[model samples]
Target: MEVIAAVAAGAIASACQNAVLSSWLVSICPQRDYAKELGERLSRNAHIYTPGSDNFAAATTRWSAAHAPEAKLVVIPSIENDVAETVKYANELGMPYLAVNGGHGAIKTVGKMKNGIQIWMHQLNGVELSEDETQAKIGGGAKTKAVTDALWAAGKQTVTGLCECTSILGPGLGGGHGVLQGRYGLVSDQFVSMNIVLADGSLRTIDESSDLWWAMKGAGHNFGIVTSVTSKIYDIIHRDWAYESFIFTGDKVEALYENINSHLPNGGSLPVDIMHYSFFFNNPEVDPNNPLIMFFIIQEGNMIVDPTYTKPFHDLNPIAVDGEGGVFTDLATWMGNANTSPPCKKAGLVNYRFPIDVESYNIPAQRQVYDLFASATKETPALNGSFFLFEGYSTQGVKAIPSESTAYPFRGDNLLISPVINYAAGADAEIDAKAVELGENLRRILHEGSGREEMHTYVNYAYGEETKQNMYGYEQWRQDKLLELKNKYDPERKFSFYAPIV
Candidate 1:
């Protein structure tokens, strides 16, 4: 290693809020003519940014401040080849590097990457429709809002994450869940081809023909950096959308969950046109002693949710009922995941999510978790902002794909549950440890209730404590395939910052 120059320190002084600049990790990397040296290898349009320098904030800003990486440099790739050049430059100097798109990944493993260079991909953003209109070529850095707006303008749509601020490939590569998944399958299922920069710094366009394509769909973070992707697109069939929300107090937990089970007996029987999202959040004003349960039943192609779904919940006598109707674009706003929504805000909050994929909600487990959550939040007022999420999306499209076809192994699971513990950043070590413990305990109740020996979790929302079998599948073949691919593609594990297979 070499000594860092005063110029880097000067930049850090200018941007005190940038985590990469504020951390002691800056001492680990040697200073060099990073801008001039790397710039020469990249295209003329490519630009390099250091802390407090030219759009550095845009490249460095993150949704959650928890377990974030410390970058010594931020390189913006104007084109696909620029990514390869940057990767090579980082490799030659023996520096760690990470790809930043939406900047929303907050897993604890990412914090392991120190004195690294962030290959900021925002400059590679755009979308182009093929002549046949059957597919769309999306830039790897493009956000969900961009793709949704672009496709909706062309009277088309595709499977994407629920949040507008998230990058298409950021979550897609993880087999991300979306409301339209019931119709088109998971985000990865829509992939046709992709331009990825492998660990060896080689850029190649791969598709179903490539042996690595199977791993790229799910667990892609471990293999390489995707620069661009061609994905299957669908015509906009239902322009209009409607949703009905039911809010209840703690007393109705059993009744509400039991009702849901009666409808989705096996967790995989949800209708393709419907999606349900529910959560428990603290609202002392509404229920001082407990969190309020908010349930959303969204329906496609209609201005009002059908009574078939809403009627049953209405019969339960929810404390409050609200409904909204609008076009497909309005769905995110209604669901509080729009670009401007609070959850989408880049607040300096430390968020830890303990996620699990279960066959169905256990009524007893739900009650226990709720009580535990209420008590924990009450004990620590700072954590009162936490929310327990239960995502119920139609599984027809997910299950329609062969279980062994892709790296995503939880297709059979019907529900996505997680306890998102949010608290102020810069908390003491004891506070952080307490948050982790509470999150784990909350998830444990549900896992025990499911009665599955192997806990299943969504890799995208992993808490970093889960085992390989928990995030991936438990089967020997799934583990063997992922391990084999990891060995072949990333021998040195350069891409191991986020949920490494090893």
Candidate 2:
């Protein structure tokens, strides 16, 4: 059976089997020896680690450490049934459990699981191409790099998240976005079927045949743990990819964004082959007084980005210019999201993102946020590591699908803007509170500029404070339907860690 996502990032390959299953067993339940008892229930390949064990720290380590989940025991499941067994064991003990994959989900809500069990899904990274070669059964614990490399070796490709380190399932469950989305749609759109362990610890393979399928595409975290998924795979179409990167000073903020609005609107007029992304970061060496703008124009099937797309930004007098030509795989490395990039590292920093989706960039809003980010980071030296991101992907393919066809809403919005607040771990209480203030303040500027009362946010990048309507959708039907399904499928709310409906 295949499932969607590589939930647990790659695991300790050589240590899949522990020296002694009972050596590191620690009591999870106060009365009974849960680890010693549960370890006997697992398969030979499965292992259990407690607080003092070396693997326990690795299992608990996350991309963002702020407000992370507190687990009494970590279970590394080697097979699909192992996941079921762990969930069942945790349920029988009446302990909160979270299935952690890539460990990149930074939402504060996950921290609510205290004295819980973490089902670390690192051993499920198996991939099998169908005999027809049109589909691949991906392991539930597979990361973007593993799945993409596996499928690419088979001369096939599928829509996946842009980052190489994140689990395809982590982002895929939240309406996965990627460069290929302009052509194939979001990663969730490619789901053919999935083997999910439901809240009751029953393993079930579901697809369009299930009434719960609609919500699974977008709000999957609230349903159950997916152990494996069969996803739609396509023959590699365009291996050739190219990008042009530019670094601009804060002085060019208005002109830079204005150029994007004219060059790359969210409508069908924007070519599907083109996508844009930019970041506002503090690189004091480049501009000591303010943040630097690093903008990128990535194109498919091109050795050089079309001069038509390059000329408008080139005219802005950037501080520096760079370009690269590579295959689809190199895109991750060039964008600094490869498996070895800093984003993949667990550097003990608390990260927060306040994300808002808008149809276009609001020029004055951009300028105002820039100033706010510069001043706040300058005042608090700890937050200098923070960055604000603006993603503008072409929406031709995304918009081609009917808005109501899937659970993912905000199909019309083009820009996914988020203010990422990063501060050193163990920072005092004041810094933590200030980081929240900056993130929310930055998002509010863009939301107010969008000129709409209803604010929409991408669930994947949300800061855990957004309303159900904000992350899901504003329409009455969308909200009503999601809540209705949440009640039916997960009335106990076992899977309500990342993004809960209620």
Candidate 3:
């Protein structure tokens, strides 16, 4: 309430770009009232939407304390012209804005605004499936579940994020990774074309024909607001089944990772119908001494029996087994709480990433990470979080395209290794400090063994205060090009928010 004066005047300034058309939503409404308004809007449209303050607050809170709250005005622009009007107003007022789809961005703070516009992109949620069911035009706001359900109903398939709540375009823009990643390629690779509203408030279509499309691949959000995205869809070769394998504690973590790295590199044509993830949890109901660690594989339809897909891991003798027929979405739900993040009880987050190599097979390094996490679990008993490690599936499909095609720079790297430590929201400062300490310890152990340091960080998984350059890791030429694009297109820095380059 105290900040309403500035926010209101600012909103007025922005809406005036097309005074005849633009609608002005309040910049700062009471949190409770904001939720009611958002729910009402959703009730009416059921399709087009701008998220409420609760949604933004929940997302902001999920971020580390260093970047808790941003984006004052939530704008729902129905058409491309409306987006142009919104952008033009922000440009004239020199106010920053952030785009939101499913609000599933991993770089939670990146698109935040101090007190500017939050252009909620969910308003554009239409999907047009092709007659052959091999492709679709998905509005930028469509979530994975929306696309999956839509495509499934049409008896087609497209590689999508395994987590149902993740937005299709949001993740695809940054090189989407999912269960199908090992087969078809990262989601960005599936991009056929897209309609984008540029910083100048004009519309442009991007695809292989335009250099801008290449730039949009990995560097998308930096240029403009995306209205819709087109991607390849495949025939439904299989349905109503997802193969699952749960590798437990005695499976030998080191060997399991090694096997994964070896198997995921083959292109999809080689039988990569399986999606994989590993989990480490301490269940009071199970074991108090050693946390229960499990690995999961979800094979779509008949792909469950594909030897290359399940054989490598099945040989490991997983302790528990559930091989059944179910909807992929149902399988995701059965997995339980696929979307619960670490309660944001802290001020900072400490994360370290290194490239995965044969050294990851070392038992000492594996135990080192596990021991460090175990101690933290005991020390901060109130902190609720777990450490995770995953490798990038092969770039066969992603790399088949020229490197110059997109802003994603990690195509050259075979795998990505990440370790995380999350804690209660209010406990961020201490939690961050401890996580950093442990991260450094793990870094030293791994790097000393592997001889690599501070190399690259995954954009989707990066956290607070680490610079943007570190996450992108482009070559000198590409970095220069990005900076040039930032200056040329967004010269006023209206898009700069959390973890920004400008």
Candidate 4:
């Protein structure tokens, strides 16, 4: 019976490739019929886009140009029921499918979606505030800026990542890190409830009370498709934030690490209202020979030059300080105009989340990473735009939450790092290979230097090179529990494309 089933599955796949069989399938199990049925059953708002259509192309465009999955059809579901129907129809056809929101995901698993249907959730974007204004319900496809702008208009704020282009729920699912994380915790922590479409085409509302809620907060991308998320919001307390940018030459790289260690002593605690990000890049305008260190310091209050916070950065004596010792602006304005906006065009990108213990920050490893970056950028000029992001956010609030409360296990203190390389489309294969090699080397150096063999990577920043054990958590018990949940919610592992747990 197993042999017969394998042959049957292979035959179906082969038939799906030829036009004659495709036409036959359409005539027998027509997609238009399904569309009509879906429209009638779940409001006539769902929009279907077939191949060779403009909507299809727009829906397929991902933020990273490297991986573009081809689809036979794309459906823009207007509501949760529409999503459920789409999933049911695709399952009936035995067609592989994926759900796309902001299209910012860069993992290689996205490329595995060949000749499938793309359930584009862009039209479901709706941001509404609750009656008491203490909570906000955001549609699954809503972008970071959309949510931030809506909440800002109502004098409210929440924890969200730095980039405004990615989906709000995309980052939150993998334990999102942001400037506000110092005070409130990860965006996943702020989640109150979520509406998810399960693998069996069943719609379910999950809250903290549900047994699956803990898994959904971190490993949700593997379990189901989220249609909407209700997150906790706070009244605007500190509206304006102080921003400071500092640039240092390569010679000052050692000093930079020393100062960071001094300020972030022990790496587990920090001032709740302050956060900083560091970048190492080869900037010809600054110094062509070596990579420059750029620091972006942000303080939650309105004060421009608070001696307590600003003095440490000033003592470093940077080569240049931009923006009048940091501009005082709201979170939304800062994100929109920030220089860290990711390029919309396609490029090769790699990310790894490295944990920084008190002893992890050393001069030799730091210098070696910087020198490696400079060499790679020189070899491929297109990679000059590439840089490493050091996301060392305060973990005070993150650690405050119980370890077993959610599946996001990296709770103590760590710097989320990503080495991104950008080159024109259809660039030389050697250039791309070198770019990837450089990123992998940096990741190895950081991981090994941390004095730990076991590595834990944040799921959102993972490059698909990590195993399920590494991405989920280093603890064996956690892995066992996640596997049990994966079996319970997705027995057949239908939602296995996006960072599969099985």
Q: Which candidate wins on lDDT?
A: 1
For each candidate, the alpha-carbon lDDT, in order, equals 0.89, 0.88, 0.60, 0.75
Candidate 2: stretches off by over 4 Å: 1-31
The lDDT of model 4 is 0.75
> Residue-wise lDDT of candidate 4 within 203-309, one digit each (tens)?
99999888889998788888889999999998877765676678888888787877777775436656777776788877677686878888876677654635565
**Per-residue alpha-carbon lDDT of model 3 for 247-348, expressed as tens digits?**
466336766666765764433332454555565666656566555666655666653445666677777776666555576556556454244423223234
Q: Model 1: per-residue lDDT, tens digit, 1-502?
A: 1346677767665554233332564565454567788889999888888877757776787877988888878998999999999888888777899998988887889888898899988878899999999999999899999999999999999999889988999888889999999988999999999999999899999999999999998899999999999999999998999999999989999999998888645356788989888999998887888899999999999999989888888998999999989988898999999999988888989989999989888999999999999999999888999999999999899999998999998899999998999999998998788899899999889989999988988999987877888888888999999999899988998999988889
- For model 1 the TM-score comes to 0.93
Could you tell me the C-alpha RMSD of candidate 2 in Å?
Answer: 8.8
> Any idea how many clashes model 4 has?
2
Point out the worst 10-residue segment of candidate 3 by lDDT. 350-359
Task: Assess candidate 2 and give its TM-score to the true structure.
Answer: 0.93
